[model samples]
Target chain A: MTAKAAMRKQFTLNPAALEQLFSVLESHDFQIVGPTIRNGTIQYDYIKGCKELPSGWTSEQERASCRLKRRKDDALFGYVPGADSLKRFLHPPELRLFRAERENGVFRILDNPAPAPKLAFVGVRSCELRALSILDRVLAEDRYPDAAYVAARRRIFIVAVNCTEPAPTCFCTSMGGGPEAGGGFDLLLTEIVSDNQHVFVAEAGTSEGSGVLAVLNPGEVTKEIMAALHEAMDRSKAAFKREVATEGLRELLYESFDHPQWDRVAAQCFLCANCTMVCPTCFCVTVEDSTDVPVRRAERWRKWDSCFTQNFSYIHGGSVRLSPKSRYRQWLTHKMAAWVDQFGTFGCVGCGRCITWCPAGIDVTEQIAALRGTAAPAASDGAG
Target chain B: MNSDTGMKPKIAIFKFASCDGCQLSLLELEDSLLDLVNAVEIAYFPEASRRMLKGPYDIGLVEGSITTHHDAERIQRVRRESKTLVTIGACATAGGIQALRNWKDVGEFVRFVYAKPDFISTLKMSTPVAEHVPVDFELRGCPINKLHLVELIGAMLAGRKPNIPTYSVCMECKRRGNVCLAVSASLPCLGPVTQAGCGAICPAYHRACYGCFGPMENPNPTALAGRFEAQGHADRDIMRAFRMFNAWSWQFRQVSEERERR
Candidate 1:
């Protein structure tokens, strides 16, 4: 089926019908992964059915805080992206490159086979989908693409959900990404909750999603369902507490390299590189070789590296960016500006992970506002 | 002598005033300990082996601090005998937690802790190894990371520089994909100023970093301290945060002192 025809077909699925969707994906040898409550935080983990989703739960996010609260209504996929992202699965923290062993005074290198698990990600948000697209461009679209990432990306499927109830830290609307699904999903779902009923309007983006929808045999879409979808989208768009003007932001950051805002932010910034690590689009890696005694056996491994490190820019003499001020400038500019120059797209997806996960409560949006000579609304009043 | 034999480099391990946790880290290299011994001659290590070879060693890994007059003199001699001297762990690099005496009167501390204060022989301050003798390198951590230890040894063997990172614990926490306790739970974390090591263990388990690895290279503790203040953290809380394992390090020392004055 063509993309246009698949998008034209819309259906409504009750809560029970959603369970059948899970069954269909599992039948296709896809390990279903979705958001679930773990250690008092909503984290994406492996789930068997819709029952494991964080139902009747929502989260409050601020500059330096996140808390899950019991909602009066049941809404799956209510919470936004947590610390884990698609980066965790595609670009793993550590991967073995190769192993070498000595045999008869000669060393032989052996390939470490990649583990490509067939995965179907359920409840992916719009900003996260954008992040996945950015990862595709960086890791898969390049000439010397990462073979492991390519192999993993090829076998996976995406089930995206339109975010109706966005967290306070959310600014996807400003980033031109979401609160509503635009594209890059196999299946898209929007939940409509009213006084006595809960229904999901589902749309397919590919043949695989259409096949899954056929098995469930959902009800025909009506004008009521479309109106509900519009309502939810509008409500979420208005709920955003933060706004970052991205138009010409790349140029503003590049021209304002000497702005004192960098030093001001760096003072409170830990240069911990947590922002890059949690950033779905930030991809940097370092390689190291470990060897056994007698130099008989050795293994090469690649682990996630961040630009916040003093050694990240290390050269023959010393690190180019030595101070926290310079390092923070490098990171912010690279994510917001240099990324556009290098990849023809912004590095950030506006998920606000960096704002919500910073131990020091540093907000990137506020810093950008400061760079623009305007004060960002205080985040100290707590979650709205 | 081993150099003439074309064998592994001779290595020595020494301890002064510490819990010996850093030396214990060497033993914790369960997977690579055997390989390490084969790669380098364990000429002198009282914690691991009974065999004690005299100095003039290729590399000497020193643990602990110079908290006594004898330690101050002995480190000088060790520096002369070893071709390369590396300090490992908090005590060797930043005087460890024992450096808390640097702020107080040692006479009172001895009298408070010991029944016979006159019998105790101690220096007024616990000083890092570099204070008494020049060090080739200093490994940062309360009990240094095993991966870094292995890498340093490998680098020494290859006559190259070790590639240990000098970033804060925030980097490690991000790499580990841990939710920030400071932001998520409003907990007072020292991760922003503390060096990355321990694989961000405390934060991974949902606790704040205790600055166990000391300050990162060119850490901006003033900014972190200001943020803590803005978050409504008490003055004592901010002061205590910087007065942890590596409190004697210049950056942490200055920050803690600044908080105390406030």
Candidate 2:
């Protein structure tokens, strides 16, 4: 499906307006984090201004591979999503839940009182926005809501960008997420960099976004600029090389629970939890309590965890998922099938971070396809 | 809570055939040393106080592997005396780098290196403390993390389990925001199979992990070795990786031996 241009809210802005947008977010006391080159890859980090963006840089990504290459034009959002996602800001890797101290034979429990940082996430893709909402369902909207996640999530201001150049690993088109910006962004942009023109076609999704746009007062969207935006969107839609056939995928995954394909995939899997770590929506966490001997102080910390870990399934007797095959099955089954039952949506957004970041180069799309073809014959049904 | 004697829990440090780097980690805890001393009596640590307090006491921190007949018998006696025995470092837990001799003939090495081959007496294989005696817990790493050493002692005193994670080193590397060298640069790394606790020191510096902390709780070294092979690494290179500090660790040993056979 082509990205429909929001005609009424669209405005054209020169390259300089992006720097002004940074200034606008900064004045409001938002810590701006966006894509920047660090340690030979584009990762989300604190940007001083638009200058910190990885301009004139594009990354080539495949299964278990990503390498940064110089683009012909100096496009800010030229590359696809990096290894990092918005999860790092909203749900931190490590968080102190509370601390208990003993003094004069009296024990006092103190909750963590650190304030959440107001964050303005720049260069957010549509799949990432979906990932944020998925996290919202898990952490904030669940029965026992995470106060920390809710607080941090409430203060975030999203600046979504439409993808013009899709990476080889990206399969967002098949999973109800595409290169176009969706409803969650405060301000959305489609970058158009050609020989004659280099500008951002902007649209405001929220009132605050329109306010920021009004301050910049960009020019009216012209016929030629809109044409270029359509071209970029069409190009991205056509470039998706990988896709998952999502039709009855939830049922297919359940039917293939005993499929031999699991063993084949498990043989290749490292069981390192890299896929879950890089995935934007994987939100499992584990808590640890530590004590300081001399001071008589105890603190509980929440750390990001994965289902792939043995301890993640540890019970009274032993680990439930003892084998690598069972652990891998739990992760994939939960993500594709059980997640729909729990959250009303598949856990994966098809951003392809898992594919590119995995050490074994395991492709989820290929695995799902394998399951669909040669799944163990149903006991009641006819032959495969 | 004190015992009937009204004294702190007695802690002893024992060494077998290690470099004593794990023992040095205790001294490296400069800021916490005084506090640790106050918490427990250093019953028998010849490395520090030269105090040779007898065992049959509390916790024993055993280091190194059983490389000789004398060391093997000593570990069994050490286990019999101590109320709780905890193995420290890769040497004590996974047999250390010296365990590479497990694949070779020690008698041949004695003849080559020593002037008097008859004088030297060593075990055929350098085996871990667990192979000789029952270990209550095992603290991994070539030279164990100073903070983890402190945590182990604190947990023992408090009658609780140590807050050590058994997950892969990749977890800590991702937490530190280090880009995957194996995925991005195609560098052969052992982080995927190695345990956490080193704070991913090697990967942060743009080098591959050498598996100093040993194989994690559930390591897939075979799959990781296959990945290394696919990356165009020679069988010798793959074999060298698994035959490091944790050479005799069954998970790593299986992969290294397979590579050697190939």
Tell me how candidate 2 scores on lDDT. 0.89
Q: For model 1, how big is the iRMS in angstroms? A: 2.6
DockQ by candidate, in order: 0.55, 0.57
User: Can you tell me which runs of candidate 1 are displaced by over 4 Å?
Assistant: A1-7, A375-384, B1-5
Model 1 CAPRI rating: medium
lDDT of 1 by residue, A273-334 (tens): 77888889988998977754455667888888888877789899989988778888888899
lDDT of 2 by residue, A200-287 (tens): 9888888888898888879898998888888999999888888888999999988988999899988988888999998999999999
| Global lDDT scores for all candidate models | 0.84, 0.89
Q: Between which residue pairs do clashes occur in model 2?
A: none
Q: What interface RMSD does each of the candidate structures achieve? A: 2.6, 3.9
What's the TM-score of chain B for every model shown?
A: 0.95, 0.97
Residue A373's lDDT in candidate 1: 88
